[model samples]
Target: MTSANPHRPIRGGAAPAAHATLPARGGVGLKPEHFRHILDTRPDIGFFEVHAENYMVAGGPFHHYLERIRADTPLSIHGVGLSIGGEGPLDEAHLDRLAALLARYRPESFSEHLAWSSHGGAFLNDLLPAPYHAGTLARVCAHIDRVQERLGRRMLLENPATYVEFEASTMAETDFISEVVGRTGCGLLLDVNNAYVACVNHGRDARAYLRALPLTAVGEIHLAGHAHDVDAAGAPLLIDSHGAPVAEAVWDLYAYAITLAGPQPTLIERDNDLPAFPVLAAEARQAEIVMARQAALEAA
Candidate 1:
């Protein structure tokens, strides 16, 4: 496990250009609806991202199209079911499958959420929240170490969009994540949309949350839409449902984060309400506009 200084100066010259590394300037999640457009048009996107679990099937059009897409543009593999925060040990079979995908695709970046998705051998298919206590932190660090060791690469851990806070939490979310980076040497996939959701749900200030974050550890950024739901008590609960275009508030938060992270890879994730490729591509273009404006400011 290793940790780097968050405030250290970037060694490269002016952040390596927008598309040199990841989120690529702006990218859209590789949805089945947009395969042809992506392949034929080859739109000016930074990269394409895919859920590693969705492509776990043996053979299908999905993998075939993905292969073609990968040949043209950079790609990122995001895992949603690794259950890295589970109380038990790392799942060897799952890791082997993930490693196989990495071997075949060789994506530019690979990431997973810091939350767990399983309990007592049952897969919940959702990123469940974990307590930010010492015991859970140690367990999560060990799991991350094993994951990085098995995959033979460092992974970016995304902050979970949590709806509930456990009484056992003894540290702030940012502190817990910073500690994880310290113990495991993994980078962060700072999802601005999640920060907005968490802030609204927990009645905290969004900008302050972002300000407290260790932006230097952030390797990528995720921008997605969320749904507002109310519980039995009629309290506001924001769900990380990537079913629509990013809201304006999220865009504002993204601007702030870009200032801190200095134009890292960013993705627009739309898993539901699957629209045409042009629609999603347009949203990606909006992200490009934002990035370009930010870069211009930096150059000035």
Candidate 2:
């Protein structure tokens, strides 16, 4: 794939930024169970997000439904298996598959987590945390650059919802992600729920984290449910389970983030213990209400 300049034309004297426009309001994650309802009902959503790995296969019901749904709604390709922060070089075959999918689907945007999921050729099947050292930053930038080059599009990197902090960490999570965005010219998929979870686990301030985020680099936002766990030390750990409704506290964080980042294409991500379409739809509706309120506040 030919590499195009990631920079976009800027107004005034500011530098050009690589930002993708999400729907001004909100969206929901596309699940297999909700495909028919989404197609038939055509809920008032800004866009739909899908795990790229889930559709990486050749032929099946998933691809058929996704293609059909893509006709109406703007779609976002969110990858869970890219392992862009892993130790080894990016998986060439995986990148090829992703590129092929992009060519076929032509989603409005693409995104992946900032964490690693593979180690020494083994797939962990989970978004594992990565250190924030210079070496790791260089590796992640290289991988992101390769991914963007292969796909012929800029991608958004999400802040991971981590449970543990590595001793080798040399930078704050926000700083690390900001640096990656600076170096690779990729946008941010700001997961507000993850920011809240990390704040709880790491004893950081959620509002401060949101305030420090590179807002101009944010192209999308993620809101998901999480589970509480107890470590061996009897301490609380919040896991990005994505299995329930958005908690009240998370909603508060979302409101704060929208106040800063404005209303980007926000998504409600629920993956396990799946609820009825109406339940998730209701969540999306609630998000829309929040976005409206935020917009109203900004105007006022």
Model number with the top TM-score: 2
Q: Count clashing residue pairs in model 2.
A: 0
lDDT digits (tens) for residues 150-252 of candidate 2? 8877788999898888899999998998888877888889998999999998889999998887888888889999999887788778988999999999999
Q: Which segments of model 2 are wrong by more than 4 Å?
A: 1-20
Q: Write the per-residue lDDT of candidate 1 for residues 40-78, one digit (tens) a residue.
A: 888877788999998999999999999999987889999
Model 2 CA RMSD to the hidden true structure, in angstroms = 3.0
- Model 1 misplaced stretches (Cα beyond 4 Å): 1-20
Per-model TM-score versus the true fold: 0.92, 0.93
Predictions in order: lDDT: 0.84, 0.85
What's the TM for model 1?
0.92
- How good is model 2 by TM-score? 0.93
